[model samples]
Target: MKKKPTITAQTKQNLIDAFWELYCAKRIEKITIKEITTRAGYNRSTFYEYFTDVYDVLEQMENTLISKLKELPMQQLSSPGDPFPFEALVSMYSHHSKYLVVLLGDHGDPAFQGKVKASMKPMIKEILVSQGAKDGFELDYTLEYALSAMIGILSYWFNQEKGPSIENLMELITELSSEGVMRKLIG
Candidate 1:
């Protein structure tokens, strides 16, 4: 029989879940380790064994999200008409709605937000470059514009109590990316 690992998987998940619950209610700086452990029903020793501090918990969470995003088939998202990739993105974000609201909202970590944008930059560039090639326009400015707009939109959507449905948000993004402001303004 395999030796049982200490700090079992469920325990780690519970710690993360508890930390998220508390972090959502108040800023990370305002939260205490005691509170986290209390909520998680774990003692300080156990918490210490797994993490260095509240920030470590946040870092762990960020790493998990980054890993998930890295696993996405970004190269497969060749066009705006590709609903599969958009669906996956929206679903992944929606699955972590509460955590996203806390992490991407007003009191969120600026560094983490920057990391999120940086991680997506390459994939965004790839998609936009492909689209721009067909549209016959300079994409340098457009790529930055699209990325900033997306972050703003995502921040807004996550903050809402009952935001637009995932499908609705995805549709709006697809429409905006496909039509663009210049075309809409010209028409």
Candidate 2:
């Protein structure tokens, strides 16, 4: 007999959730399979059934997030004269704030952010190129700056206990991206 997909997914999620709780409190190096299994109310063997080790759990979580991000209608947002899709961006961040807040935080893996930026680079480059950005160093720098700024803003916002509302966050990013920070600050 085969196990139901829902049950398997739920089991995996329980393990991931347990690992995430511990991950948020300390570095991954400090986490252990024993602890995760204990917290998840499962035996050691069951943890192995779903994950080879602690790091696997984190990797799976990152992969899931990136995969979901790739599913967004990013191409539509790249059309000329269309504002950057701040609403979609904000909604995605808000929906995943719980995981992202920690994944991009002090205790999280530094390489995760690099992975995220790499995944986003192509679409962002497409958008920039559509807006008349030329290839080479300028485009490279602009891509890095844009990805860094957006991630930085999200990290800061999600870390806040009472972060701005979604609409406000989207508006703030729009103004800063469109008008430039210096203009927003000076005027």
Q: Which candidate is the best by TM-score?
A: 2
User: Each candidate's root-mean-square deviation in Å?
Assistant: 4.4, 3.8
Scanning candidate 1 in windows of ten residues, the lowest lDDT window is: 131-140
C-alpha lDDT (0 to 100) for residue 118 of candidate 1: 70
How far off is residue 139 in model 1, in Å?
Answer: 5.2
Q: Compose the digit string of candidate 2's lDDT tens values, residues 1-187.
A: 9899999889889999999999988888999999999999999998998899999999999999988777777867544543355566667878998888888888788898888888887876676566665657766666677678888898998888898986788778777776773232222
lDDT of each: 0.71, 0.78
Error of 1 at 148 (Å): 2.8
User: Candidate 1 lDDT, tens digit per residue, 29-131?
Assistant: 8988899899999999888978999999999998888777767777675445441256666666778766666777778776776677677766755664554
**Which residue pairs of candidate 2 clash?**
none
Question: What TM-score, to 2 decimals, does candidate 2 have?
Answer: 0.86
Q: Once all C-alphas are superposed, what RMSD does model 1 give against the true structure?
A: 4.4
Task: Kindly provide the TM-score of model 1 when superposed on the true structure, using C-alpha atoms.
Answer: 0.77
